[model samples]
Target chain A: MASITLDTVGKIYPGGTRAVGDVSIDIADGEFIVLVGPSGCGKSTLLRMIAGLESISEGTVRIGDRVVNDVEPADRDIAMVFQNYALYPHMSVRDNLAYGLKNRRTPRAEIDRRVAEAAVILQIGPYLDRKPRALSGGQRQRVAMGRAIVREPAAFLFDEPLSNLDAKLRVTMRLEIKELQRRLRTTSIYVTHDQLEAMTLADRLVVLNAGRIEQIGTPLEVYRKPASTFVAGFIGSPAMNLISRRAVPHLPVAAQAGTIGIRPEDLSVAPDGPIEMEVLAVEELGAQRLVHGQTGGERLTVAMPSDAPLSDRLRLSYRLGSLHLFHPETGRRID
Target chain B: MIENRPGLTLLAHLVLMAGVAIVALPVWVAFVASTHTATDFMSGTIPVWPGPHLVENYARMLDAGVSTSGTPPVGTMMLNSLVMALLIACGKIAISITSAFAIVYFRFPLRQLAFWCIFITLMLPVEVRIVPTFQVVADLGLLNSYAGLSIPLIASATATFLFRQVFLTIPDELTEAARIDGAGPMKFFRDILLPLSRTNIAALFVILFIYGWNQYLWPLLITTSSDYYTVVAGIKRMADAVDGLPQWHLVMATAMLAMLPPVAVVIGMQRLFVKGLVETEK
Candidate 1:
């Protein structure tokens, strides 16, 4: 329903500590944008700024056509689902879903209609009369979603809403949220530290490091061509390996910058390969094996078939197109 | 069951029983005295058994009271005590919860200064500021009223402090959620905060009720009319006979009545506390 535009957004605390730097993102209408990073990288802070929960130190945030820098959170026409669910503990599920509508002074019949619809959509209809304490963690999370769904706001802001659940439930709820967003077609900005969640749920993922935007691209796009060495290392499961260019007896050195990046899956075992490695260990992950070892004083991990031959003394090979080159001075991608 | 420590278990039971006996003995003695006649006490050694005047003395105190002392009936005095206790407990909770909410949620110049000012009142209790407080109450013409008996003692910093601690433990996410849900400050307070802190408020109410009911000097100083006399202070007025020995049996009966309501309130509030703990399913 709305496009969110964060133009040069930054947040600095009173003592001059920068939590987020100059970061800009254009989220198209109904696009699911995810802000993701490790802890203290300001992913949550950026999400909060967009939700109007935190004050922006610099820049303008536009929702639809209006600049909402000074608007109160209540007037901003947005709904947020928190990491802990933040359900009103004493209210019944029905009342929890109705709270926002009632606050907006919607009529009694309309409140009931929306609450019923949200409860059914979240499949929490049986818990409509029960307090949050009587519900399981997964149930509480659904109720939290129900609360947001009832609002039918311009945007949905999720701050790691599935992190508190068990791993299996997190997966289940993640799918539910993705499906719900697709159906509602509501513009959303989600924040998480889990790379898998970011990769699966986002239309575009914004990788953050040290309060600055490292890269922004679609899931497969970022996976195929990362914008920086940080994105190359952060986006993949086994993590891409970055080694000093001097470590290998390279035939064609792209730059004098002295860094090379290759994803674990791209490197394979080849008997006549040029790169010599001494295998330290191997992790058999059912379908694939993560081969960790050393080559010319640099540590590297290679993902190969589980059924493949394994040995202590091994040779590794990767295509020139799959190789990533970076300037050693900066972590930016140079490929 | 803990580590099969039978010796330690037996020692614990003995210590507990001794503690219970030591605490209950005074109330038992008061009960026994109230059941006896005046002649029963003159017999020097205090009787451990109940006498025949149990119903008579209580009924007399409740109905006629100590007529010679010129005070109102004990029934009227007990009602006064109930009103004062209920008002003080409820008023303190209302004032403290709102003040604690404001102090925790809002930021302004002198906010810390305001918190410290409220905290300093814990050191300056009504006992310490008795004279000036009484003067202020008199100047406001609040003497001989229920407000006179309760309001001067209800601005409690301890209750405010307890509520502040409770409010701080609430996650900041809750406030954000309420804001995003379109609840303003007061709406969030009424709909969310008050329900969440029910256990704290209930527990504080029990303590404040006893503190208010047991007040002696403040009520005695402020109330000149018999209509406003609380049970605890009224007992003293009844005990003061110019030239005669105090009516020992009636006085003991009045004392028993004075102690009953507060004990009952404490027990009742404790049940609510337990209920709150059990019903909190998480």
Candidate 2:
């Protein structure tokens, strides 16, 4: 319902430890943006800043037409779902969904209507009377989502809301969340360290590294053409193979000295390929096998069909123009 | 429980029985004394067996009370004790919970200093600063009133610390969630923090009520009127006769009455009290 604009947002703790540096992101209305990074990378910090849960040390965050830099979180018209669900343990699911509306002095009938609607939407109708403690993990998560949904805020903020559930449940909940977002079409910013979750759930992802944004693109766009070595390794599974020019001296260079990147899925078992590698290990992953090996002192991984022929020394090649090259001094990608 | 060790189990049973006997002996003797006539104690030996005057002696204490002592009826004194106990328990809980919430959630200059200041009150027991506190109460014209009896003692370091510990264990996400849900700070405190700490309050109520009921030295020094005498402090006056032998039977009966309410509270709320004590963090 609202476009979020972060113009050079930053967070510096009182002790001078910078948690998040100057980073800007412009999110279109009804966009699903995921801030993904490793631990201590400041993805959560940026999300907190946007949610108004953390004090902004610098810059402005705008939700819709208003610059919400000084606005209270509640006044900023946003709702957040935490990883723990944080359903008031004492309240029933019905009360949890109705709490925000009641605080805003919404009419009693309206509160009931919204609460019932949220319960049905989240498929938590049967549990409306049960306290959060009695509900299962997935159910509690739905209540957490329901709490946000009932608020009808301009945007929704989620901080790794699916990370606490079981892996199987996590996938189901992830799909449910994506489908729900699609239906509601509310602007949302989700933060998580899990790359797979980020890729599957985001309309666009902002990959962070050390308080700085490394790249921002749609999932497929980031996968097909990463902006840096960090994005190259972080986006794809079996991590795009990164080789230093020092290790493979005979590899082609792109007008500069640096590392070269090739995704595992892009590599194939070719008999006449120029790259020669000794297979160090092979992992059978159902339909596809991951072939991990050494190519002239450089570690490489290739995704091949399960029934593909294997040898001690395998020849591998990537399709032309699929290579990603980064500067030697800096990790920035070269055109 | 994990093993069937009969000999060790028997030893444990014997030890437990001995402890129960040792603890129950005083109450048994007091009960036996209340059942006897005043003439029975004149023989210079206390009776162990129950006597026939049990109903008569209790009715006298509850209805007419000891008339010669110039103190009010034991019934009135028991009411005073109950009022004072309830006031102290409720007052301490209110002050401590708010202070604990403020200390834990708000960021103010010298907040740590303020916390350490409250902590210092713990080290200085009321017994250590009785006279100055008594002087303050006297200046405020609170002496001989229920306010005097409870207010000075309501600044509880232990209760504040207990509530602070409980509040600290609550997840930070709950607070943020409340903020995002459009709740102000006080609203969050009332709606979320208060409900979460209900068990802790119940447990602490049991402790503080007993503490307030059993207060002796402060009340003895402050209240000059018979109307303000708590049962626990009044029992002292009953034993210290002006010009005659002390009414031992009536004193024993009053003792039984004074111990009854708090003991009943502990027993009745035993489940919640134990839950409040043990599972406060959860």
Candidate 3:
């Protein structure tokens, strides 16, 4: 296991298109870091740069003590799992798993042993002789992971590896990958546009926007204390509700000048509260109800327990501590 | 499905059957002509059916050259044709596959220019440059030899184009995975690219084999005597006899013998040919 350090890493394409700005991040040894962002946010590009698949235009990437900016990908001692599984369709599952070791000139018997061990760990033993085209999507994903695992590299780089599976299968594979990482404790850097995956899978989430890192923190830390309006709006499901209030009583006056952020879960129905809202729509999730409505010319959403009853005219209260305040001009969090 | 449209289905079948007949007609005629004697063929008295004269015609062609002239036998010409065709096919395929792999997988200086240069050769057919090519071969001291016959005609633009298009269809992620798996360029090409391109390789092999087998002009111009003549050139010479009247029987037999290897290759690799064409389009 090894730590990865990106010191002012930047990728500026030809014609002066900056795909990644001066971004510096230090991932501890055996840390699971998720780089999460929307499309065109440069998360995948950063991941590729880390894997030595793409050249860094500026700054250095150090893996374990070596500056690998000029190193070949094959010499970097890292294994990558791609979103499409990227299994060699022509090879059998056993061959796919054994390919890396074979390339390193590992003995045939040892390659066989590692292949068997990986297959058992991935529960893909029965499919050892099957081509990737013949296997199911989940099985193919396992083979992709098996291929990486058999290499025993210093770090694992995953580029949305579970994105291609079905929704139910994606959850299972996500948990499997997490447990596998825990068991192996290899430093890993995963890139994805899905916030849920990032939140659930990462020990630390690195949220990026417009090629710049917006915030880096633990899942709970980022969720609870977003550094900017972007992180506040991007982190939660159904998204956090933002509104312009003339004055929120508990908020500082400086924070009141801009947009106030309140998560859907942070708002609740109360007979008496600060603001009155009209319940325009209600979605009945199994455990909670998402109340979508308008409050004083601003759209607002509140999540209530499924058992709660809503009136046409509802008053909602938000915990002051849970409120996120951001400056309108800079989008930086104020309170 | 059967009840949907009977007349249209019947028309489609009829059209397909007619196409098959048109394609098979020449082969049938060649086979029938190979079995007949020159006298019987010229008189048009022989029926269009299999005959016992097949062995006689073969024995005549094989022994006629031996008895009439103190020259190299027909078997030697057949062997020369086989060697030339094999070398050209193998050499062209090797060059095409390697160059295509490099262009597709590796990043190098002036790659696009190199690819375009190779691709432009497809537009310049051998017939267009036969004279200059002959001069070059003579200047290189390679004339009147197997190298002259094979090397100039062996370099293929069509195979390179075919392989490049096929290689483009392979997902880049597979290459990335291979690289991250500690595979160098040579290992990746050998283990991944080559195996995945088997269909394209098979298709190009058949095409280049046929082109090499049927080559007439270059071999005719380069070789000074019957000893080095390919089957096509040899058959052409046989067709033009000393009396100025064509030897129809021996020409047909030699042509028939020449067609066998390529026809066999096509039949054996038909599946790969279809798949490779589809992949190239993709």
lDDT: which candidate is best?
Answer: 2
The alpha-carbon deviation from the true structure for residue B119 of candidate 2, after best TM-score superposition, in angstroms, is 1.1
Going through the candidates in order, the fraction of native interface contacts each one reproduces equals 0.87, 0.84, 0.89
**What lDDT is obtained when candidate 1 is compared to the true structure?**
0.89
In angstroms, the error of model 1 at A326 is 0.9
The docking quality of candidate 1, as DockQ, is 0.75
DockQ of each: 0.75, 0.80, 0.64
Write the residue-wise lDDT of candidate 3 on A1-335 in tens digits: 89999999999998999999989999999999999999999999999999998989999999999999999888988999999988888888888888888878999999988888898899999999998989899998899989889988889999999888889999998999999999999999999999999999999999999999999999999998999988988998989987774534444445344888889888887777777888899999998889898877788888889999878989878776877778878888885
Model 2 regions more than 4 Å off: B280-282
Candidate 3 chain B worst ten-residue window by lDDT? B64-73
lDDT of 1 by residue, A202-258 (tens): 999999999999999999998888888888889989999989888985636676556
- Across A11-68, the per-residue lDDT of candidate 2 in tens digits comes to 9999999999889999999999999989899998998998898999999999999999
Write the candidate numbers in order of decreasing lDDT: 2, 1, 3
Segments in model 3 whose C-alpha atoms lie over 4 Å from true places: A247-257, B1-4, B44-46, B63-74, B279-282
Question: Pairs clashing in candidate 2?
Answer: none
- Report the Cα interface RMSD of each model, rounded to 1 decimal: 1.5, 0.9, 2.0
Tens digits of per-residue lDDT, candidate 2, B208-252, equal: 999988999988889899888899999999998998999898899
Residue-level lDDT for B65 in candidate 3: 47
Q: What TM-scores do the predictions have?
A: 0.97, 0.97, 0.93
